[model samples]
Target chain A: MIKRGYWDIDDILADEEPIMVQVTKTIKGAGFLNPESGELDLNEHTRFTIPLWLAENMATRELAKIELPKIFGESYLNILEADPRIISLKDRSNYFFEVATKLNDFLQDGKFITPLQKVFVARFVHLYNEITHNSDPKIIKKLTELERDIYEKGMKTTREFFDWRERKFDIIRSAQHVVNNAKRFKLK
Target chain B: MENEITLPESEFFAENTKITIIPNFKHAGFQILSGFYGPLRPSVAIEVPLWLGVFLKRQQKCRIIPPAWMDLQVLKDKFEEERKKEEFSELDFYYMEVSSLLLAHAKEDIPNHVLICRLIQDLQDLRTSKIRNSLQKITVENLYANFKDIASIELQAIRRLLPATYDSIDYMRKTENND
Candidate 1:
């Protein structure tokens, strides 16, 4: 199967988290007021946690600046450096790409990327290129094996999700097309 | 330089799976992954793999006849039955993908393309409505249960709305807990 570099929107939506941000300008929240929190009353330079979805909106309007948490800081780079497996790298690449694209879209002029985010993005791009272009036979074989393992796991989960035997059979037959495409990859 | 793989559209279907084709010209046979497929003769029906069928169909060399299960009457019946149930009826895992492929790429070959399209749309609308309704009433445990029945394509279609729906549900539950 031909692998394409694309992000799954469903996966992104499912993975959103609350993130801390420093308010750049005092702004009263409109529809986004969390009823439990009463109302969003922000003052310039104050830091607070907001859901990432909401943060995207606020950041776009220049109301706040994202504060990279510990997870997305030096620790992420350490994790990638420790185990640069294709699977893990692919996951990190997807995550960083999604986050970066979202933030870049919203970021105004004069705002700059955090030092850690820049390092993470640079490392991710370097690793992504290495894996995509590597000609080593052993690495290619391992990548192929990992692809097969992912397909099998996906199919198994899909099967367990459905209740009817006939439905399971039908899904397997249809999903075979996807599995076949993934299995037929040729390293360039 | 790293080269990203680009997939041809037909890669969405299982390769080497047999499909019926009606040819319009005479030509020499060719070999493929599974085996060889024929030199063509006009008006003759032959079984060939999905890849060859797609290739021939694209070149306008032959017309592809869809599988038996893809019949308009069968699909209509299934759609009607599924519409009535709170849960979706058992269907081929590839039913959505294959039907879409036929509709998009081989419309002329389907005798009742209009009817087929309408039935599929109605069924999809019903499913989407059911899912939306359930989303409003969801609990954490039931959220996972509801997701199991959603097709990948359906999930893609609804991805934009899901985060907000999930957040509202989570907020409501938390408020209830406090109360």
Candidate 2:
């Protein structure tokens, strides 16, 4: 999901998501990665949890094979498939969709691709219809980071329309950053 | 790709649309960047840009004539057509902006402006539901959607969301595991 060396903060943060992989070949001088065990080298056939970025690299080189996380397992996917609109995806993972996208690439089965599209489309449709009246904080709490970005963008358009309807058009406004920056400079 | 038009920008462009206005002041040609309009005479109705009409109307110097589509009977018939058809009924590209501007600045000038305002709002609500219905059709296998006959101002409402959603969908469908 992340392009290594790209200037994407979200990608960088998403790359930090820990993933599980089984070592096919022992890696030397890497025992420090697993802080729980005081070992000198990573042993062969040991199941290890590593960040997404490293796991992909190791798996591609035949040094390890990735195992789908519990969230990507059949039971969780079945829950997502049953009703996508009501689930609190944020509780499961902040970068749920982003990590899923990356995971789909490793899975040549095209496993996560269909469910990703299905979940996004179903939740997106529900968000579109009811977002204008989304005053309740509970609705936003259910959204993951990607979904939150979409919600905020859609909400901005609705707010602009409502402001225009209320005839608040003639006022000159300050940029959002300017307003926020001003507060920091204020003396206590 | 044509740049996405924002709400205020769309309203600003709609201000350039011409409307008929009856002035109470006599004046020779008033020149503006857009061109020469003018020779204003008392009680004489003449066509002018909506912005100029609203400006003069605010100063109590002229009376604005509501656009033809604002008539109650006309709107009622149009609403009926909108209900019967799956496609959006053709409306003036600037209908949303024009009606909002007229209703805000020259309320007294438009006959039965209250009923006209309500009708316009109801029509907008109907069209919005139609948009939501079409958006549900978007899926990974069938991404191409034919959104035809939508007006400029109405298009502005969903401009940001639609394209951004499509882009996200493209991102999700990334195939090359290499790059």
Candidate 3:
């Protein structure tokens, strides 16, 4: 809980900077506002959209020789036959190969959103490599590069988004706190 | 109208979702969700739709395994735990994962899905964290408010999922710009 008395202020005083937590909060609060349009920011809402991308990456990575005993007992192919998206990708080699190329290009030249989407891509590749370590060393080696880049981009984008949101929400909450305190002061 | 409305089936709990063993047995389907799996066994893996995948991932939280802000060392530990346990048969894992994933992403029933996920995780972790449970309750209430934000017609789905809170209340319809 990092508790201390006022006398311990000397320890923090030598740090030579006002604790920056409040400033970060203010920035995050303001982040919910759009700079160009003066409208409510919508990008902050998109964080919830990551699951589908992660799932897609998982499905494609582990494609072929996949049998779903739950969906259809030993007839996994029959279920995929019913669902189009499962069979859309040709095969594992082609799917991962194409994803690697696409991810490399995006990392090299894509916008902020591209990197954000690739976070799940990296996780997928890593999981596959972990599971198939003994059998598919070659595929794991190839995906390692893609996984590293995608992971880095995902982390950066996630940090920026949260930092921006924190700054915006902090100010909004603080102002409300101030108003309540002021009303109490008047009452006193 | 009472007779006509078809109920949405949870794919996760359906009888159709089954598993089978080959060569040794002719007719065996795995029913892991309703059935039990012993600790340290492999479970089947199910393939799910894209939308569902996104939904389940968000619901996963920090317990023994790391949450979104999990440390590398903790993550490594989780990887080891995953390696050691082999409860979910390949097929059961696929179906369960996919169904849970899809249920997580189903926007109309999101609150319910989120509730189930959090509750289930809590159950698994043997956690009694009030903050976690309260946050879920708050989300469910917010989901109720958001349901009212949409057109009244869409409210029916929300009502079905949240019958106790929503059944008695009537939504205030905002005036459309066209009106």
| Tens digit of per-residue lDDT, candidate 1, span B65-162 | 98886888888887878778777666654555556656766889999898887776677667756655554454344453255566544553334334
For candidate 3, the per-residue lDDT at A142 reads 42
lDDT of 2 by residue, A45-96 (tens): 8887999999999889998899998887788989998999899998888888
Q: What is the DockQ of each candidate?
A: 0.02, 0.44, 0.01
Query: iRMS of candidate 3, one decimal?
Result: 21.6
Question: Candidate 3's residue-wise lDDT over B15-131, tens digit each?
Answer: 233322111112233335445422221233333323322433344310111122122343344434534543211112123233333343333433344554543343223211221
Instruction: Rank by lDDT, highest first.
Output: 2, 1, 3
lDDT of each: 0.53, 0.82, 0.29
Candidate 1, chain A: TM-score?
A: 0.41
- Candidate 3, residue B130: lDDT: 21
Model 3: what is its DockQ? 0.01
Q: Which portions of model 2 show Cα errors greater than 4 Å?
A: A1-5, A133-135, A172-187, B1-6, B137-146, B176-179
**TM-score, second chain, candidate 1:** 0.65
Which one wins by TM-score: 2 or 3?
A: 2
i-RMS values of the candidates, in order? 17.0, 3.4, 21.6
